[model samples]
Target chain A: MNNHDRFVTDTAADIAAIARTEGWLVPPAPIGRIALRPWQQAVFWGLRIYIGIMLVIMGLGFFHVAGG
Target chain B: MSAETDILAPAEADRITYTEELEARLHDRLRIQRLRSAPRGLANRLALGLALIGPGLLVMLGDNDAGGVITYAQTGATYGFSLFIPLMIPLGFIAYLVQEMTIRLGAVTRRGHAEMIWKRYGAFWGAFSLIDLVVANILTLMTEFIGIRVASAIFHIPYLVTIPLAFAFIVGILVFLKYYTWERISLFVAAFNLVFVPLALFSHPDWGAIGRTFTGSGWALPGGLFSAGFLILVSANIGTTIAPWQLFFQQSCVVDKGLLPRDIAASRRDLMLGVIGMVAVAISIIVISGQYLHDLPNAASLGDHSVLAGIGSRLGHGAMVIFALGLLEAGMIASIVITASTAWAIGEALDVPRSVNISPRRSLYFYAPAILGTAIAAGVLMLPHVPVGFLNLTVQVIATVFMPAAMLFLLMLLNDRELLGEHVNSPIRNVLSVGVMVMLIVCNGLYGIATVFPHAL
Candidate 1:
């Protein structure tokens, strides 16, 4: 068998064996997983960056308001 | 024929059992692993509940800043506590509606207010909201320091001396502590605000008068100026109870607290309890001031920062000391929370590294705002001609104006099906939210007109 097939076989067998020993059954891998698009991740973090600059500006404004 | 059929069925049976048992085992293993990582027995869940509670409680108490206390006190002294008590009834519900939305939005989105605005509305609206928030936050922070300075003057300390020290202490606490630790420390400080409640007892005002005021006599707004000023102060009182910063702060804190979607119910319960505590304490302040000081000629003048110096002479040194401590604690804790919220919003909006969890060097964006906020607020206090009252009034007006926009964003996020799925706000919540937004718009409109034409409304 090829290396990829052999590795899958070994891993599945190990999981199955462990399950049996622990009084459990081995389940199949999930069919789907969540994956954000590159652009989405970029948008999410970009929003965070804008908020940071505002906070710095707001904080400095305190000195002017404090009137020291 | 029977034996052959039995053999075929047995083969199929074995295949089915193997698949079913394997699936069960995998599920069990995953469950075990999760439990091992974070156990959810009674003890563990209770501990988590306690830990999750700090931010909600601190944010609510922070809402009851020193200005809030004095406003409530002045309301009582001026109106004798009748109308204000019932007003708090609706006010509490309003507080709940507004605050609960924040908890939901925060726990679900895992993004702060500024961040959401930046993403959804673009930079123009984002910058507008940020500018309003920053201006309002700085102004509010000034009021807190003013409370500190006024309270210090009661004890014969210079405002300058007290202001710097208070700033240093607030910065040191926020800088050294993470979110969890900062919350815990702030809660301890918030507890001191209960001093006002007991001070109510020391006043020994007629319980009968106080009760009658609530149940029978209407609030006295006979004159024109009194009526106008009363509405303004009422707006201020309610406005102070659930300002826009609270929406940003509490929600950001929820996300930072690592609350999952499953924790939404718990977080709401936490927020409701906080709203109750906040309104109860504020009413108590008003009640005390009304009962004891209503007969005095300059009762409303008690809110005057300059005249507040006579508090000790009137209330006895012991009572004054406790009141002063309460004032100091309220202002300082508010300064910390507001500053932190200011930092969190900026960081969240800009996608910069922020949070008390990260070290100062790594979290410069987070800590920088907090440091700058305190410094400038302290500096404002030192200035000779800062027009502190106008600044305070401007902050309230700004909050009143921007409130509708904040509420609009909140309502939109809460109704987002993609984000909330089945957890979106129900019909009743939707109606209540819309009603609140409408009321806020009216309040702001009237306020604007009144500002422009002092005699009209």
Candidate 2:
């Protein structure tokens, strides 16, 4: 099989093993704290807006509108 | 099953081992929620996204160092932003294309650029590339120090005080911080470059002129002394947008940060954002310069300091002060990154010890290049009539000429089935890369003609 197929197969096995090993599972509180922190939210918003501005500028760039 | 199914099968087992190490490395941040009875959710995806963000962003911002800022500044001051505006679009795409390959190569091979070069390309070719990088890096590092010196001079801070202090601050950060902390703190510093955006508003330029620049009609202006000077600025602009050290730095950082295939998409996204950020800040420099300094009767004679001060003055004292602060921040940020790149390349290539995780005492080999690079650059900046302008111009030309050599190695390694396999670049990527390489060659040729025979036009 190809590398992609091999990757998928190997990853499936690893996930299966991880599921079987209850010790590896993270609890929900830690998950929420890590994922929902205010600063973390800020990074998300910041990146999103940054990308949006770029897309608009890129559109303008295509039309030869952006200043050098 | 074939005998290859046996656990001892060399290739398959090696692949398995590689994947395992990569997964364990990523495990801390991968954060897969149990979907079986627990639930499949978006939170898992978000965690993965945050984890992959560093390498690309670092590479993009890293490319827009002090050298790049000055190049963009010069371009705007000399040319008034007409033809170069559209060029940024293609250049940003080239930055993304070349960098994305490094991401794949590092993730798949688990080797730094230096190590791969040493192994596959043989010692002669490897040493050649290494020497070129080290020399170019030393020269470029000097430019960063010069930037800090010039920026400090704006506020009447002497170079003697600023240069050594800047060195100490950069060494302190790299020596004390681990890979993750170093990356995060550098991003914070890089973020300050965006201060130029609001500063750009003070230029009071005609938006129509800016818009007209992109339409190609504005680009058809007469080619004379003005165009020739602008061409030099364009060469500088290209140099700032694409640099050789960037590939080495990002690939090493990816391996150092333990990015895996799963992290690749987020890394690309982060890189795309960084490119946009870099280009926006770059254009802001040009706009600020073009609006204010371009009109100065003695703008050329005003020298580098006058040009910088001219931009600062237009933005009001508060803005200029902030711009100076941004200069210090951006210069320091680049110093840390470039110094680290030098250290890492040396360590990884020579098989000496490396990584910021090791104590300074333990990783002296790694820290040595960084410390030495900073000292030499600082030392050079303190000297009289140090050929700052000529060297700055030469740095851009040299970088453009040498860019293809580095990009070639990256492309070949990425395309090698033994290394990247399915991760190899798509055909479209190959075409785009070739196009970028050709464009660089032609631009560098024209740039050489303009510089060597300035009066030819």
Predicted structure with the largest DockQ when compared to the true one: 1
> What is the Cα root-mean-square deviation between model 2 and the actual structure?
13.9
Q: Deviation in angstroms for B441 in model 1?
A: 2.7
The two-chain DockQ for each candidate, comma-separated, is 0.04, 0.02
Model 2: native contacts recovered, as a fraction: 0.00
Alpha-carbon shift of residue B347 in model 2 (angstroms): 0.9
Each prediction's Cα lDDT score? 0.65, 0.66
DockQ of 2: 0.02
True contacts kept of each: 0.01, 0.00
CA shift at B37, candidate 1, in angstroms?
Answer: 10
Prediction-by-prediction clash tally: 32, 1
Runs in model 1 lying further than 4 Å from the true structure: A1-68, B1-48, B224-226, B295-307, B384-394, B450-455
Identify the runs in model 2 with alpha carbons over 4 angstroms from their true place: A1-68, B1-48, B225-228, B297-303, B454-457
Candidate 2 lDDT for residue B6: 41
Give a tens-digit lDDT track for model 1, residues B1-457.
2112232343443343333213333333333233334756887666556655755777788888877766676667667766787677688788888888777776666667777767765665567667767767887888888789878877789887999998988888777755556667878887777777777766776777666666757556744433445545656676677787888888877766645466677777777777777877787777766665556564443543532544555677786777778788878888988888888888876778666555576667777876897788889887755454334433554565556656766776677677667778898999998898677655545544454455787
